[model samples]
Target: MKISELSRRTGVPVASIKYFLRQELLPAGRATAATLAEYGDEHVQRLRLIKALTALGGLSIAATRNVLAAIDQADSSEGALGAVSYALPVPVAAQSAAGDEEEAEADATAGAEVAELLAALDWQAPGTSPHVQGLTSALKELRRLDARYAPGELAAYARLAESVARLDLERAAGVDDPVALAERAVIVFAICAPVFELLRRLAQEDQVRRRAAGDGAEAASPR
Candidate 1:
């Protein structure tokens, strides 16, 4: 098909498609003449993946490029999974007071707490993981607010996270195509994250209502 046909079929504008081709986000179509080229089904699929990453998954072009490279170079399922994992954005930790000794000490303490928590949970994430940084930052904030999770509570949260991760990996393993699997990983998380949060909020509301009406199992049980 011609570029125009590719653009029409994909619902991507001609200018944008041209830009993608120039950026090498979309591969160049087969040159047919000085000013014309022919695209195929693979181009359509690639364009859809690019749109999903940029438009729906909210990845920047650079990140999208890295993810695409990962897909292209991946030799195994684990390699593809690792590529997507590393390409995903990490949450940046908030900065503290500049050159303040006490603030530095507090930050160090939070880092220690994060390490301890991860150790207790038996998670083997790298020290450089954004999740570790984010958790350390959150722990610092909790200390500032004089609020902290009990060890048992933190452990429970870790267990739940592990279960969710296991389910995600299982689903990813089912896909035969590495590129499609990588795309699915990003799209599934983007779409399901909000839905998961909403379900948690709804469950909280239901619990509150049940307690207020003295109808919950815990509310009805002997105190």
Candidate 2:
């Protein structure tokens, strides 16, 4: 197949495909002549994957490159999983006023709470994990808002997260191909994240309605 055929089959524009080729996100097609190249099914698959990573997965080209590199170099499913996990963006903690004792105290408290939560759940994530850092920042903001959740409530949420993660991993299990596993991981992580958030928001609306009607669950009750 020619590049035009590859572009048509993938529904990616020729210019964008050329850009990807220049960026090395899509591997170069086999050179057949001075101004022409022959593409194969592999090129089609690669272009589709690139589109998914950039469009559906919401990854920047640089991040997409890293993810592709990770996929190319991955030796196992865990490696693929890690690649996708790291590619997803997390919230960054905003800087606080220097020498503010109250703000510093809140941060320390949030960090310790997160540490305890992780320990109690037996979830051994690195302190440097972006997810951990994001959670810590979230807890800090939550405390600042005076809407801090009880430890048991947080633990319950963590358990639910653990279960969700297990289910997410199970979706990709037994796939031996690195590219296939990476694609599944990207789809499950990137697409399902927004789905989960939207579902939670919808559930929150139902909870509000239920509480207004004096129905089930009774207004969250704050644990």
Candidate 3:
């Protein structure tokens, strides 16, 4: 396919496609002549991956380029199929439920919002996983309770999630086997979430109780 079709099919502009090629983000296609070349389905897939990285992965072009190169290089290697260079999962969202307009749009939009916010904040909190989606649902509940609230207000919770991410990475560092490390990381890390939330809630309740007791004692004292 020509560059024009590549742009049409990918929904990305032709100039942006050329810019990606020039930046070496996409590999050079077969050189048909001095000024033109043919792009194949592989090129289409690569371009899609590039856009996905930007749109879903929340990576800047420079970061996307580096990640693409790393991925491409890894693909060329004879390493075991399960081996990965980084701890991050591939940037991808799941297929949404069909035949439900509101449900689908809400999920898709929230996924995009979550991706951008997470990438911008450099948070790695399972952007498309069940946990993040549940978090998003919780956020919607928050919004319904107070329509004035915005999603940005909720991301402050990242301080805790990131604290967990740090702890998770440290725990994984002690394990050498990739499978065992991943298994423990996901399983144990997920269990920590509810416990951590409970601790925070309990601490807040204790503070509230203390303040209430102080107020009652003051009220009971002679004026």
Candidate 4:
């Protein structure tokens, strides 16, 4: 297929496809003539993967390139997952916590709390992990907001997060192709994070309504 056909098939613009080629995000096709190239099904698959990383996964060009390289180099499922997760941009709060001198104490406290939470759950991850660091930042913010969210208060949330993560990993584990698995992980995390937040808010509203209705029913009943 020509570049135009590739664009048509993938719903990507021809110019954008050319740009991907220039950026080395997409590999060059076989040369058919001095000014022509022929793409194959592999190219189609590659384009779709690139689209998923950038569009669905919301990765920048540089990040997408790194992930692509990781996918190509990965020999196993864990390697692919590591590459995908590492290539994701760190949360802004976590980045700020890492650099801000004012956050040092809070970061340390949050780190200790997180360590305790991890030990309680028998989970292992480096303190420097982006996910761990992100959690530290969030815990720090929560502590700043209220004394109610003290060091040990995150255990319940952490347990729920672990349950969700286990389900995600189980689905990924069934995938045989490392590249496909990486793509699935990236897309699922990127899309589902916001979806999860929205669902939480919806559940909160439902709980409030249910409690309000129960109170109304009790008030209307005879003593």
Query: Using Cα atoms with residue i matched to residue i, what is each candidate's TM-score against the true structure?
Result: 0.87, 0.89, 0.42, 0.86
lDDT by residue (tens digit), candidate 4, 1-223: 9999999999999999999999999999999999999999888878888888898877999989989998899988988888888777666453443356767877788789889888888997898788888878777877776543644556777778888888778868788787678778877677777787898899778667767888656444556
The C-alpha stretches of model 1 lying farther than 4 A from their native spots are: 91-99, 216-223
Q: For residues 1-223, could you state the per-residue lDDT of candidate 3 as single tens digits?
A: 8888888998989899999989988888889999898899877767776776565544578766665555545533212112222323432343334457766666666566667767877865565355566656544444334542465664666666677767756755665533343334433443444577798899778667767888656444555
TM-score of 1: 0.87
**lDDT, candidate 4, at 107:** 77
Where in model 2 is the C-alpha error above 4 Å?
Answer: 92-103, 217-223
Which parts of model 3 are misplaced by more than 4 Å?
Answer: 1-105, 124-128, 145-152, 214-223
The candidate that achieves the highest TM-score relative to the unseen native structure: 2
- What tens digits encode model 1's per-residue C-alpha lDDT throughout 60-108? 9988888898889999877777777676665555665546887898889
Looking at model 4, residue 184 earns an lDDT score of: 83
The residue pairs that clash in candidate 3, if any, are none
- How much lDDT does candidate 3 score? 0.60
**Ranking of candidates on TM-score, top first:** 2, 1, 4, 3
TM-score of candidate 4 relative to the true fold:
0.86
Query: What C-alpha lDDT values do all the predictions have?
Result: 0.81, 0.86, 0.60, 0.81
lDDT of 2 by residue, 17-50 (tens): 9999999998888999999999998888788778
